[model samples]
Target: MSVADAVAPPRIRCLAVDDEPLALGMVCAFIEQTPFLELVGQHDSAVAALQAVHAQPAIELLFLDIKMPGLSGLELARVLQNGPRVIFTTAFNHYALEGYKVDALDYLLKPFGYEEFLRAALKARAYFALLAGGAAPAPVPPAAPEEDHIYLKVEYQLVRVTLADIVYVEGLKDYVKVHLASAARPLLVLTSLRRLGEKLPSRHFLRIHRSYIVGLGHVQAVARGTVQLRGQTLPVSEGYREAFDQFFNRWK
Candidate 1:
């Protein structure tokens, strides 16, 4: 082998497919900009992309759009099955849950910048790397019994809060108010509710609405459309009702 060939780093071969020319071009551009991703083909139709993937078994990743003419990206993905890893790109947020059901590596919402695209690409790279090493990707672990606290930023200082002491969290636009069982006033922190929810242990916390996340341990009652925690009633919106019911039923 040549010295250059021996020294060159490996890259993940990728394909970009979207019904729109502009969206396809943007995906291709992002792929080209990434050092570890090598774009092999860019197609404006799922049929063409399907052909390309079949012809080239070396392609390890696909940047696919979910909604396409004739053959949709979701249909193509189902056909491909275990053929190649996929990172779905689309404008609609409602497709996210379905995309995950099909084992998509990541979902990039439309008008996403390079940062979001790169984040998804890197996830694919890591999955490939794990496969190359002959090891299965690790599953997310459940919350440990010993892990019972988290630190939150309040104004200029970080205050440590015991996990069991939290009653609920209220989201206010860009900030969240953390209500504690022992405190008279909730602590206001400058962070999104979604972001903060990710930090809390999933076993203890559940998001019931876009504006609220409640501690399961602190919940006193559950009604038709609301959750009661420490005498405070919080509505469980339609979007989260199914998930909340599933979990609630499991404990009964």
Candidate 2:
């Protein structure tokens, strides 16, 4: 075999579950087109998927739907022990936060085309490749932030707040609540965690979870891969752990 062929891992065994027939078909089509993925089966319900996983323990990846009739995909994921790694495909963006809580590999917002599907699929492939080879991917290096203050819209008003005043940020669907050291209540604004992450000074802030971004200056402690703020404890996911660790090590 050629060097590339020799080094390439075997095709990842996968299954798909979605209540929507068209959406499920798209997932199946994506798997079929991807040379590195092998679609073992596709089901219309989480219940069927449970049986499939039980029968075929070799399923390494699952394209699951979050909203199903009986057993929701999230419910199935919660109950299944040692189930395949999940990549949730859903029409609702609100479930993005919940998906990470269950440690999903990735979340694909519905009406997502092949390109978006391929991106999520690629992440799963890399994750499985690392698991099979006993190698972890390098963590992304954190960048220095130069901005001191950020502005946000709250109740039809633009509020300017200093970066040092921020304790942390909490994401809820399309909106984020900015907790500050000076304010009694968090500032609520309609924006995504991803967008806020980019706007914030990366050096002083870290996205510790899918739903949380914490100011490094405000972090009192980190225990068990979780960041302890003044009153809240935020989880640091495996994907963001490396960067957070590197940042913490430098600060300490």
Task: Score every model by TM-score.
Answer: 0.51, 0.54
Model 1 TM-score on a 0 to 1 scale: 0.51
Candidate 2, which ten residues in sequence have the lowest lDDT sum? 137-146
lDDT of each: 0.82, 0.81
Tens-digit lDDT string for candidate 1 (89-179):
9766679898998999999866455776877877786687677774433443432334557999999999999777889999998789999
lDDT of 2 by residue, 1-252 (tens): 899777777888999998765567668988989998999999999999999999999898899999899999999888764678999987556798889988999987654556667878778876887878745434434335245578998879999987778899999997999999889999999889899889986656788888889876566667658887777888899888888887555323
Model 1: C-alpha RMSD to truth? Answer: 16.0
Candidate 2 stretches with Cα past 4 Å from truth are 134-252
Best by lDDT: 1
